[model samples]
Target: MTQAAYEHNGRSVERAAFYAIACDPRRSIAVEACAGAGKTWMLVSRILRALLEGSLAKDGHGVQAHEILAITFTKKAAGEMRQRLNEWLVEFAQAPPEKLAAELLARGVPPAQIAAQAPALQNLYPQLLASARPVQIRTFHSWFAALLRTAPLAVLQDLGLPANYSLLEDDTEAITAVWARFYATVVDSPSARADFEALVAVHGRFQAHKALGAALNKRVEFVLADAQGVVDASVPPFDAQFPAFAGLAAPEDLLWAQRPLLQEAAGNLGRASAVTFSAAGSALEQALTAHDADAVLAALLTQKGTARKFGEKIVGIATVRAAQELALQVAQAQLQHAAWAHQQRMARLTRVLIAELASLKYERGWVDMNDVERAASVMLSDPVLSGWVQERLDAKVKHLLIDEFQDTSPLQWQALHAWLSGYAGAAGAPSVFIVGDPKQS
Candidate 1:
């Protein structure tokens, strides 16, 4: 065989071996594969195996159609998976014995057991069609919405949501309206106006609006971070000290005091290393003469705040070396302070924006996907409500297959973890199959 063909066949065999283990119904598994690696095919294969083996079901008579839940990242993916699974079942039911045996073997059933598996494979189509509750294949949002429907009215009231709240698929108009109201309120309130002005001064009006919009889009993440105490709003103080320039309170003052010495050193280095030092020397001279601290630091250090090379000719000059080191330290400290200040501003702005948006949503009786996820998480975590929710979910689903798992948000994972935590090692515990490609994510 050609080398390329041989290598391709080798990979095929390896993937088949992996499928054998990953598709086993008795074991819960997680698989990460690159795009075009047949993740959908593997997911479908696992479902079929679980149904045929019946080991994952509490009743031990094979998993029913209603007992299996498949969650996908997008609606189109969920649709595609459902279509593929149905097509496979139809094909399996009609194929002749030999064809059925080949299909079974290809799906990871042992060759010795293919004949014994044929009857169950043929029966799956009719079984699914007769099921009172068809298998649920839904996007994460869709599944969460369905779960929320089962929540008690008292719980919904606790979440500040109406009994029949409408899902806002597109929240653009609502967000724009909230922003206008927020801007008006900020103008009317002196304290809020000051914060707005500071934010606008740092980022300019357009960028400031854009930053706030981005923060609103990631409100869920901010809420989770705040709850975990991972976000610190206090601005970090710039405390870098330079012993070489002890009395100089500012970088510009230090540069001005050492102007004569720096100019002489730069002149010498420029003459020795014209290609590397000439441009920096000229810029340094101009900045020092201008008495601009930021410009002087930029000339003395690289963009990453590292001191520029001064060449062998100027290395032995102690005073010049100390000045360069001091400039680098000042640049580093200034950068840190600026970053911390920006983060604090963004955090403060985001908090206000989220509050305004929440009020708007509440007033309109609207809930977005983020709200759905949060509500679901709250329901799953509540000590009293969780037991009730678990009982309902346990009766309906015994196997979970999550596709595009890498794209799942932290909040979604938290809810799933809370819901599944108690089932570990318990009687009739559900089996989970997760597959995704991190590279794709």
Candidate 2:
């Protein structure tokens, strides 16, 4: 049977790959198609090829058949991409297999068997395959989130808790609990106490600082589950594990690719990042630091990248300005939610316990960035969390596929790197496939 040949739009790297792919399929290639180069069209074909080849089948010992993970920059993009893929599948499905076979031969796919699969390609193929078997198609965030949810359930069970215990909704919330427990366990340790004291000195209060700490501990719980009882049981007792937060592989494991960069920027900041500023400084102080016209020029160029390091710095200042804007927005939103909740907690305030929301915010205990950075830093840097996350990645998938490579944060990428390092150390495994648009950077 023949396969479809891509319509050319001059020199698309994706075109080269597409021709080669229609000739023969490979997983590690990047399709560097520019705008109007039919990148999405090619993307649809790649997915179809994967599906026809039984790579989408889940009831296998070899190739994975689970729903292909597709991630795009926006919810709209994802929807459009899914719709297009379905439409193409149906289009191909409606065509006679013999005609498609001739078409494949005329275009490229000479596989005698591939034509047989064409009739199997229905618009409902994804849905039918998913229902009859196990197929899923979801954006990256949604799927990873589901995995994250399952991770903790495995952890709590490993910790020997009652069977009915469930993982929490937010990782930050769970981490707070675990770190509180960790602190309770380690209160007497001389070094731990000294460190705790140092934090109190700088921050004004030493009590109730385990928000993200507990978050990482919750990660530990999941790692233990992956191990099936291999982690050191004596290190600490997790009354509740951080099942949602699987410590990522390692920093370097994340690629400096475009997709990751966008993912991080969008997921973390609603499509904005540190590069949003166009002023000399994110704050007026920065503008004042510059001398004369060069400073003004630099500030003007601050929102974007430049040829020199100075330009980059200027652009970075713009990003800082952008961050400030974002922070203000977040602060405003949080204040409203917290204030309303505070009022409810007080319930017609009058006495001290029932006073205004401000009093309650201070009295009832709350956490912010300080707690998040400190605790997450500890768990991620720890030997146990890093080791366990790497092992799980290596054990779960023979191939590592990461999307939105450019938008991955340094910390998040590091988690994947740690895993890759471990995999390379072990040998006989695939190196991570990092794909994304550098132009998007």
Candidate 3:
């Protein structure tokens, strides 16, 4: 074969070998590759083989429709997988014997066994449709919601959720309503109002809203952090003293003390090289006049808070040296101050936002996808409830296939691990097949 043709044939051989391992129904595997590398194809093939093999199931029949749970990252992906699986099953069911045998062989079936598997493959489509419970192909959130729905009534009541709680796929309306409630309540609350003003002053109203929305989207993370006491205790209060630079005073005090030296240096630098130093000089002069420690710190350092360089010769001057020394101290102090202020404001805002959102959700009998995931995870983790939940899931599902597994949240993975832990090395344990592009994650 020519070089190009030889390389192509080699790739085909490699792919065949890979599929042999990946598509084996008995083996659990995780497939990670870049997009368009047939991760989904391998997943679907594995599902098919599991159905055909039938050895994993309690009955002689292969994994039933309801026994296989296939989860995707998105609804669109779930729909696509469901469609492709159905299409292939239909083709297998209707194709001529030779064609059907060829297809089965290509899907990693041994030649001698094609006839035996062909009958089952041909019957799969109708069996799937006629089965009392259809195969589950769902997004992670949807699957979690379904799991939550199966929780006992007492569990639902303990979680402060209605039995028939509606899922909020789009939480825009709820967020807006929560913000309305926040605005209404902030007027009467001094600390909340101060926190709101601080956030608004820094981010403006529109950006502040967007920031809070982003935080809300990651509320699970916030919840986890809060449970660990990281939110309130991690950042010290803004006004609290922080040790730095031989017990240097506050940034504001340092800035006021160094103003005269900074003013002198600015004038000398401006006169020495107008084009090079005029902007820095003007900024320093303005900040000194305004007695603004933040602005002075900004003028004295790079945006990232490194010491501002005004050439070796210029910086060697006594006034400039003194001013630079003070700048270094102020920059260190001010950076800490900024961090502390930000942590405080965000902690306050996020806490309030989470509270208001939960209140609104409770009032409306609505739960977002995060809520479902969290509730399911909690249910799976509870010592009392986990056994019952595991028993129910073990009876229903025999194989678990997760598409875009890398995109699964920590909580979702935790829940999956918790449930799957019970089945480890046990009889008829559900086989797991995970596929994803880590690059995409």
Candidate 4:
């Protein structure tokens, strides 16, 4: 069918060609319709066309009522869709072809096409009603939950749990309890004690506690990389990994050998290197005074990069340049290891916390919404279980309709994509129909 343009208030408005696209029942359609632009009417019409045309059927009279899955974001929206679908079925069951044709024509369908399909629609409604055991209209979460319930054994197997678990109504108490357990252990455990000491040494006790608390909150969303086994308790140690700063020429060796300006720069560097109170600072200071290139390099390595105020002793142009250079090196070093201990501690702590949290939930046969999605995602990712799921759904669902597509999470999408794309028969794979407004998503 060709695209149609009609007059709307005072201007020409191009009518959406959704009827033609949706009527084909061969390809998927994703519509981003504005509010009050007949999105519901269009979707209902598309679903009705799929039913009347018997296009979703593999080798039968037509697709069953339960074969069409329509998912919306809200329970209210799902109710409305189910209600409207029921109304459409009833209307076709009772109305004559001419009347049905008139209604289709009003909805922008071609006259001849509507007349041809109206009779079939009238004939198909009774069977559709008879076969409607469970209406497949549901909110996204409810649908995913239903999928888990459908394949409980497969879900448990895929997640490697002993049996199916009950979902917790709320995770607040569970989270707090698990956190308390981890906190108590960390306060007394040997490894945790060492981490705490190191962290305190670098950032002080009060600052360390604040920093650790912040890191804990942030680590909740951190997924372990594949290489880092999920149960890996150890974090990479910073001290062992820090490059050994040895066998290097001093800063003066590189800059002092050039000219008067270079020698002045070296002198300034020497003065800047001597300002800190650390052993490295003292060694760097001695080496600078004695002009020992190798010793200066060694001391620079040991220096933790602290700065001091030197009122008028630092004055020359080269001296200023040398001070900036020193400050940059010191500042870079400090920034690099500023939270080295905290990070290592947090990584170890987070892994333990996550493991403990899972253990607590599993021991109690409880899971949260996130756990629900995770299990569902695992089921979809598994070849055997995913195939089984797809086979079951393929026989029941032929068209996938989603409302509020923009609000779909990655895991939710993964579950849906797996089922829809994994249908066994190649000839009649389910078509996806999505509608939403980006502005309101």
Candidate with the larger TM-score of 1 and 2:
1
lDDT on C-alpha atoms for all candidate structures? 0.76, 0.40, 0.76, 0.61
The TM-score of predicted model 4 comes to: 0.68
What's the residue-level lDDT of 174 in candidate 2? 37
**Residue-level error in angstroms, candidate 3, position 205:** 2.3
**Model 2 agreement with the true structure over 1-441: per-residue lDDT tens digits:** 643344333433443444545333344445443456455555555455555555334576433434344444446666776787666655666777676665444333546655555554543455544554332344444533343323334542433333333333233553333444445434755754555555455444533243223323334333333246433332222111222112423111111112233222223322223454322233223333332323322433333423112233332334434433433333333344344433232221111111122122223343222222222333334456545543553334433444445655444455445534554456444323344556775
Span of ten consecutive residues with least summed lDDT in model 2: 348-357
Colliding pairs, model 3: none
> How many pairs collide in each candidate, listed in order?
1, 48, 0, 0
Per-residue accuracy of model 1 over 363-423 as CA lDDT, tens digit each: 8888888888988988877656767876676545778999989998888999889878856
Better of 2 and 3 by TM-score: 3
Weakest 10 consecutive residues, lDDT, candidate 4? 239-248
The Cα error of candidate 1 at residue 203, in Å, is: 2.0
Q: Which wins on TM-score, candidate 1 or candidate 4?
A: 1
lDDT of 4 by residue, 1-441 (tens): 743333333344555344555444445878776688677776777677667657335587666656778887788888888788778777877997678877766545666677676767677666665664544788776766666675757457645444657766467766777867776777878897677677678779788657655544433234424235542333333233333322223323332343344345445544553454234445655655676754544543434443333335444544544533554443443344444545666567666666677777778787666666666776676668776765665546777788778788766787778766666566667788887778776
Cα RMSD, each candidate? 5.9, 20.9, 5.5, 7.9
